[model samples]
Target: MIEERGRVLSVEAGAVWVETVRTSTCGSCAAKAGCGQALLSRVGSGAKRGFIRALTDRQWQIGDEVFIGIPEDAVVRGALWVYMVPLLGLFASALLAQAAGVAEPGMIGAALLGLAAGFAVVRWHGQRAQRDPQMMPQVLRSAGQVMPFAPEGRLNG
Candidate 1:
């Protein structure tokens, strides 16, 4: 599970809106002086805050700090769908246009059209996935709460 700490902004039915600040690790990285990402990070320092609606069963009060988690597999799958689908569409349509003896200009148009269609598909999938529980992040627990330690092979008493 991947997790982040956030403060609860509001509570709704079966969910809570949490605010988190994006922190960059560039300051500690050895390649900070040579990395393009480090430069971009410095340029965008003002817009680091983000709000997320996290699913949770417990009712949390406003201003409560909590941890949220999502499955690693979910992140990987989402990244693949968002990137690979459009690329595949572009190449497949361009190849088809070539096989049909389309002019270079026509092939380029076909590739662009395919890329747009792929983006459309991704948008549609995103809307559908909004209702999928597995795709949503869940509130793990309040950051202030402590877990009881259980001894080896024994449950907490």
Candidate 2:
């Protein structure tokens, strides 16, 4: 299980909207300042928030700090879906075009078409996955649990 800390923004029924900062595990690495991940992180320029259903039956108050978790398989599957499949589609289509005697300029168009097709498939898959509870992140622990959390200033900084 991969876990992250978040502050509860609101509670509706059993689900709470939790606000979390996207912190890089490599933020302190020697090469981070020159890395594209760091650059993109800076470009995004803000935190992300999402709603997760409470795992336990307890009623949670507003402003409760909690830990959210998603299974490792879900993270791995999501990464593959978001990165690998589209890349393969682009390269495979380009190669197929090349093998079929397509011109260099037209090969680029073939790759683009493949990429769009991959994206369409991904979009369809995402919509389908949205209806699956096992694919969603869940509340792992609540504030009353024996976990120590830092203040907002630390997380924001």
Candidate 3:
């Protein structure tokens, strides 16, 4: 499970609104001093956003610091086909068509069809994946002695 901590902004019977801290990866880039991403981050450092999601039969109150859990398997499987399948399909279609003496137009169509099929596969898999128990997120109260949820790291005393 992958866990993140966030503060509850509001709570309803079936859902809780939380605001999570956003952190940028630009700080670790080798070219941070010259990268456009770093420049943008410097200009946008203090901006914060709110996120809202429905809870699964769990009740939380405003000001609660909750730990949100996402299953590791779901993330790994989702990333794999979402990125790799479409790329492989496009490459294979183009290569096979060219090897068989297919014309440029025909090859283009085949590649496009492959890409479309890849997207359809991903969409279909996503729907089915959501129905799987491992894909859901669960909210839990942090360990004893609650502390404020920090966006960047563990709560500081």
In order, what is each prediction's RMSD in angstroms?
9.0, 4.7, 5.0
Residue 122 error, candidate 3, Å? 1.0
User: By summed lDDT, which 10 consecutive residues of candidate 2 come out lowest?
Assistant: 145-154
TM-score of each: 0.89, 0.73, 0.71
- Among these predictions, the greatest lDDT belongs to 1
lDDT tens readout by residue for model 1, 1-157: 9999987777999999987778989999999999999999988758777789999999888777899999999999899989999998899999999999999999999999999988998999999989999999999988994333232312245
Q: Whose lDDT is higher: candidate 1's or candidate 3's?
A: 1
64, model 3: CA deviation in Å?
1.0
Q: Please report, in order, the local distance difference test score of every candidate based on alpha carbons.
A: 0.87, 0.74, 0.73
Over 4 Å off in model 2, which ranges?
32-57, 145-157
Model 3 error, position 99 (Å): 4.2
Model 2, range 126-152, lDDT digits (tens) per residue? Answer: 999887767876787875532233444
Better of 2 and 3 by lDDT: 2
Clashing pairs in 1: none
Please give the distance, in angstroms, between residue 54's alpha carbon in candidate 3 and its true position after superposition: 5.9
Error of 1 at 70 (Å): 1.2
- How much lDDT does candidate 3 score? 0.73
1 against 3, candidate with superior TM-score = 1
